[model samples]
Every structure is written in structure tokens, then in C-alpha cells.
Target: MNKLLKYLLATILAVSFINCTDNFEDINTDPNGISNQSLTQMNNHIGGSFTPMFLNVFNVTPAWNYQLQQGLLGDVYSGYMTPPTPFAGNVNNMTYALVDGWNGFPWSDAYGSVMPFVLDIKNAVELGNDPSGDKFVYLANIIKVSAMHRVSDIYGPIRYTKFDDFTTTGEYDSQETAYNAFFNDLGAAIDGLKSFESDSQFVPFDMSSLGGDIAMWRKYANSLRLRLAMRVVNVNPTLAKTQGEKSLSSDAGLLETQDMYINTGFAHPITVISGSWGDVRMGAEMESILEGFGDGREEKYFNPASDPALNGVFKGIRMGIEIEAKGQYGNHSSIGSVIDGETMQWMTAAEVHFLMAEAALRGWSGAGNVKAHYEAGIRTSFSQHSVSGVDAYLLDNTSTPKDFVDAINPINNIAYPSDVKIAYNNTGTNEEQLEQIITQKWIAMFPDGQEAWSEFRRTGYPRIYPVMINNSGGTIDTNIQIRRINFVSNEINTNSTNVNTAISYLNGPDNGGTRLWWDIPGSNF
Candidate 1:
């Protein structure tokens, strides 16, 4: 009986040990840390994080963020759209008065919405030692370059390259250094993605119109590489040629037919322009250039002015106005429905073709010639807008940009700056040809005012209107106009030490008067 009692006790202890061993992992596991299973659920963490980054870059849902992110700044500065309402007692961005409160949106929105999500996937993929880690890391790198370039373009220097390290996280890279990093990042992405051409994991996670095809993304990246290469041609021609030729020579190809558009799952921000808000309207530049060319796309781009005094003509407001309320210029031509679609354009083939055209002019390899590339760009834009008679429009060498006529306030009207014709003139000087190319490119890139503003700063082609009132307090030159926005107050307040150090990177003051690294103040020729 003693032997039987010992055997029963041993059996009970063995059962108890088995139960503890079986439940150990479940009991010890923290619910907070993401499980490997959860990481693998959404195409290896790419879908969950990438979607928000892509969507919020444009900030489609909240109209006010878009207002500060673009409409009041780039749109106004680029000569694309101008707000009718004069907020802050009419002393605001439109009047060359930089609003610190409004100026912080682009930086805040980017760091808050876009970069965090990108960093998450980057960290996760690196830590997991996932077999597809290179593929995920490379793709995120492309998005990072694309998104951050805009930010750098906005404020000149930005928190890139060292953004991941908490110790040096707030350190800013000068625009030149940031651009070099961008090129390197893009190069890695192209090489890494080429190996994963058949990887179907990206398909479910894509928010772009390319349908998650790795090859398409590669092509888009190549096109983007060309765009960035062309951006630096004035400042760094050798680097520009090297990168441009690399993209031009790639079998992955450029954005030949399709424009890069992200479906934001929300309406385009232009709805705020044409809809009930009625805050924004066509710019004087748009009215003059479109009407001057007799371009058929004008009607598609804007409505006739509602001011009965103007007799239903397509009128536009000047950049700066001291209106008591929006009602003053609210009846001017609002933006058209073409920009009100679900997808937001990142880049277009028309703009790319013009880049190639400029490249050809610079004698870059693989860009056929100036004339062919120029005409192709115009034709592509015509087709994209569903406007016919491209042949006739291209033949019109007599039509120069018309002198702007402000029907409401004739004081704002100005004469055309250039006699540049529509036809591609091989006999013309290099400067003449460049102006023609950039002007058409500017028109093709309508409503994407941010890129247009950057191009305007770089090339100084397609002369934009000066602000009616110079409220910049002698900081911004009225003739030179606003070059780049001052680094936002958020950076000044939260990251004061780093922000102070960054001001040393600027060629001028840390104000709108300063030019960016790529925007060398001179003729491209």
C-alpha cells in the first residue's frame, strides 16, 4: 500500500509539470508586442503602414489641412490658385506675409502622418530577418524619397538621413545632401525590386494605380529618378546626366503614357476650390496663358467668372488682396472638376517628356532630340486632357503668352514677359527653347502647384505674377518673389537647437528670401 501511494503522488506531479510546460508561452507572452503572425498577416506589414502614408501625403479628408499644406502657399505662389478670402486681416501668405501658424502644416502633416508609418515597416522588416526584407525595405525607400523630396523642396533643409537615430534624430540635412541620399535610396530600390518581379506580396498592399505590380513600381521609380535628375541639372550637371541617362537607359522605362496617381479614398482637394467654400479661384497666369494659347483645355480647367461686370469671361484674381471677405472675389472662376477626381497625381508623363526634352537640350544621352521630345510632351498633355486639335495647336508659332488682363482690377494686369512661341524652333537660342519647354510643362502640370512652384523657382520660365501688395516687410523680394518657405515654427519651437543649426545651411536668411540647393539663381543656359 505504501508503494501504491508513492506511485500515485509521482503521477500527480508529472501531470502538473506537463500542464505548466504546455501553458508557459501563453502566460509569459506580452499582449503589447506585435506577434510574428500579425506581422505576416498584411503582406508582411507593408499594407497596414504604407496605405496611411500614401493617403495622408495628400491629406484628402480634412479640407483645412490641405488648405495650409498647399492651397494657401504653393497654389498661391505657383500662380495656380488664389484664395479670395483675406484671413488674418488680409495680411497673410497671399500678401507676401508668411503666416507661422499656416506654414507649419506641411512639415507637421508629413512627419506625423507619412514618415512614422514608413519607419515602422522599415524597422519591422529589418528586425524580422524576413526573406523578403530587401523588397519591403526598397519599396519603402522609394516612397520615403518621393514624399520627403517635397518637404525638402518646401523648407530647404529637413530631418532626413539621420531621422531614425534618436540621438541624432533632429539633425537636418542640407538640401544637397538630402538629394544625394534620395538618389542613393532610389538606386537601391530599383536594384532590389528588379529581383522581386514575380513577388505577389505587393499586390494586396498597393494604393497606387499600378495595381501593386513590382515592375510598374520600378518603372515609376525610374521616371521619378529622371525627374529628380533634371531637378538638379542647373546645380549639378554631371550628376544630373549620370542619373538621367541611367533612368533613360533602363528597361524598366519611364512613365511614358500613364501619370502616377494615388487613390486617396477621398475626393481631390480641389473640391474645396470649386465647391461651397469658394475660397480659391484661377490665377491670373492661368487665365492669360490658357486664353493666350487659345487652348481648348481652358474650359475644362476653370469656369467662366460669375461677376456680371466681367460679362461671363474667364477672370482670375491676383495673389494678394485686402478683401473684407470671400464674397469680394468669390464669384471669380473656381477650379474645374478635372482636379476633383478620386486620384491625386504625383507625376505625369507630359512633365516627364518635358524633362527629357530639357535633357536632350543639355545633350544628355538617350533623350532623342529637343523637337521630338517637346512635341511628344504637348501631344501627351492634349490626349490626357481629352482635347483635340493638337496638330493645329502645335503649328501656331504666332501665339505668344497674352498680356494678363484683370477685368476686376486692371491695376493687377501685366504684360507678357516672353515672346516664346508655341512651335519648337530648332533655330532658336538655347534660352528660347528652354522657356518654351518649361512654359508648356508648367501648363501641363496644372493644379499640381507644388511642383510648378519648385520648377518656377529653378528655371524662372513662364513668368508668374507678382503679389499686388508686398507685405513681406523687405524680407522677400517683390521681383524675385518668394523663393522657399521659412522653416516652420514647429521646428523652431520643438527642435530649436537643430533648427538653429539648419539656418546655417541656407545661402540667405532662414526666410522666404533664401533659395534651395538646386535653385541656383541664374539662367539654365
Candidate 2:
């Protein structure tokens, strides 16, 4: 096949999943064909592409629309919510189920769907010169690391042996190898910084909105490497520490992604462009944590007006007690709530700052003000969510947070205000850092429902109400949150061997109660 033919074929398979309900027998003809377009045009489409991808994958669609954020329903976050009452068996517990076998979701959409064009962009970059190629490479690395981290986090391992393969006999690789490849990609990305020396070539890469900016992409790559390394600390400490240290040692400038998140409006999912509607909202687990902190972002993330009150409210349902109707979508008075994609975000400066703060806390030596990063995270979180500052917020509090600072007890009192630095002085050990992190992350993840769930599951700090109604699986602990989402129905049929093997590692049926590799313990009633 000719070069054009190969690109065309690859493009076909890529869009095949875009979904066409009608006679789409052969309609996948590269709606955004980049091979014929220049590097600039290609980057245009990719510039803000990640916003929808991240929001969609996490299940943070507009709840008013009934669109589900895949990860939202996952047992990680809102699994705490039940049926006619709140959380039910139908909810997804991603850590256990969504990552492996057959449930790996649209989270990897960036990896499989958006990434292929990166290869084409590379060709375009090579065809051009100066900032074009360099900027593309850097952005490619940023996207690459982001996607790989998602894959590694879920499956624990993947086939990175021969990436972007179109041939036979190329199977999946181990997670460790995938991490190594991630490091290599980071190195390549870091090298793109020099490409910015020639003044950004806006012709082939117009980052004025998002892409033409290579310098920012470089920081994103480094920071992302830090995140991936930190993530693998348990699985590969030596590698994690080394990579963390390496990224820290570098002078590859650090810019928060929040400074430039995807604020796309009137686009598909959010708009009628794709002719699609999505609804994802703040999970009860998340809302509880934020409310506890009196987080300012909750106003942005959650609707202040009670849609359920207007309509009928469906709280929680029994998991497996054989219940009939869980509840209706909008059983309250009205039929609408805001689930539109108007508020979607990709990466944010706040996230970058938070990651830096985490790196500082973990002692990942790098060019950053750990305290400033910490404060940045807090302030940016407020700014991101349009939250009020600490003072005004505290005034709204019934009592100063400082009053309760020393009153609470954590699993690790040492990790409290003393060692964590950020926790120091502001609120003594009793302040609940777990809630703080989740509260901030929840805001930063505006329109990102799934990530909110992930943070909630990893910490298990917030106490939550079981459910207004229950579903069929079983009862969720009033205190202990749900563990994992059940393996999807399809996996049991196709990848039964791996599915069964994975189940053996799980405590129960790999349902909402099963835990993932990283989650801490919880009461699975």
C-alpha cells in the first residue's frame, strides 16, 4: 500500500469507534484527516481535544443530561450513592473491573484514538522545520505519558513491546516495561525544549490556544513523568525514585497545566456539535469531602440548586437484596439539571502545582517551591472552582478550621501537620489532609468525575452515607466505601481466563466491593 493508503486505513480504524448509528458501512473516511493537512491544522484539532476525553472517561458528564461519566459510577467515588435510595449494584467499581480484562474504558481514549495522529504529526513535523517538529515531539510526549500512566494504573501491565504496531504476533508487554518506555518517551519530550529556540512556528503549530506552545508542553512532560514515577513507587521503588529524582534534577522549567486547561465551549458532548449529550455530576462521596472542608469549588463542581428536591430524589438502593425500581433519573419536580459539558478541563496549572507539592512532600528534588506549590494548589483550587479564599471561607465556617485542627486523628498522626508541611500550623493533626487533597483535586478536576472517584478510593478518608436506596450487589458500609466495580459482562465471556485469575486475587465476585492494586482497606459490608 502507498503512504496515503496506509494513513487512510489507519484513519479508518481510528474513527470506526466514533459511532455512526445509520448506514455507516464506509463513512469512517477521516473526518479530521491530518495527512493531507499541515502540522498547524493537525494541532488545531488536537489542541483542545483532551478536555472531552478526560471528562468523558471519568464519568463527570453533566448530570442534568443523564450521561454517565464511566468512572463516576465506578465504585471508587459515588458507589457510595444508592438507588431509589442512592448506590446500587449497577454502579461501576473501576479499580477492580474498569482497568482490566474487558472494562478498560474510554480513559485510554487519548492513547488509542488521539495518539495515532501524533505519529502522523511527527511526520508532519519532520516535513517542516524549527519549532514545528520540536513542539510536536514535546506535545506528543506529554500526551504519551498521560495516556501510559492511565493504562499502567489500571492494568498494572500492558503491551508496550512494539507500540503503534500494525503487524501480527505483537502481544501485550508487562507494566514494568511500559514504565521504562514511559521514561524513554519523557527523555525524548524533554529534548524538545530546544525546539522552542527558533521562536514558535505558529504556521505548523498554533498554540495561541493550546498547541503552538512547546515550552508549556515540556513542563507538562516533566511533571507528568514525576506523576508516573510517584505512581509506581510501590511497584518499582528504585525506578520511581530514580525517575522522580531525574525529573527533579532537571531544569526543564515547570508550568502548571491549569494555566492552560481545555476550556472548550459549544463543542461536542457539551455542545450539539457531536449531536451528543453527556451528564456527570459531583459524586456524593466527593460532595461530602468538599462540604466538610467548606471547599469553595463545590459551587462550581456541583449544582447549588436541588434538582432532586424539585423532582423525586433517588438516594440509595440495596445492592443484592432483590429490589425492584432503584429510582428514576429525575423523580423530583423538574426534568432538568446541568449535565452539559460546559465545564470540562484537561490538565491544569492547579494539578501541576499539586503534583509538585506531592513531589516535594515525597522529596522529588526539582525546580519548585514545595510550599509555594502547596499554597498554589490551595489558591489555584479556589481560583479554579471560583472558590472564596481561606479567610472569607473560614468566616463562613461555623468555627475556625484551626479550632478543629488538633482535634482529629489520622491513621498516621506523624503525616499530620508536622511532616506534611502543608498540614502544619494551619490546622493541627485533626484537619483531615485526606479531605483536603480530595477537596482540592475535586475542584481541579472540574468536569472530571472519574478522577474524583479515584482520589476518593485511594484515600478512603471521608465518611459517607451508604445510599438513599440500595441496589442488588450487597450493602455498602456506612463508614467504609465501595471497593471496586464488578468485571463487565463482556469480560466474563471473552477473557475468562484472565478474568478468573484476576478474580482470585479479589475478595469477592470482583463486584463493587473488590479492591484495586493501590486502594487502602475499607469495610466491605
On TM-score, the candidate that comes out on top is: 1
Candidate 1 TM-score over all chains jointly: 0.92
Estimate the overall C-alpha local distance difference test score of candidate 2: 0.45
**What's each prediction's TM-score?**
0.92, 0.64
lDDT of 1 at 411: 75
485-506: candidate 1 lDDT, tens digit per residue: 9988878888999998899998
Off by over 4 Å in 2: 1-104, 107-112, 122-135, 168-170, 197-199, 202-211, 263-282, 307-343, 366-372, 394-435, 461-525
For model 2 the local lDDT of residue 266 reads: 29
* Candidate 1 Cα misplacement greater than 4 A, ranges: 1-35, 38-41
Candidate 2 lDDT tens digits, 127-192: 555354455556655665665555444444343446556662134444456678888888777875
Q: Which ten residues in a row have the lowest lDDT in candidate 1?
A: 9-18
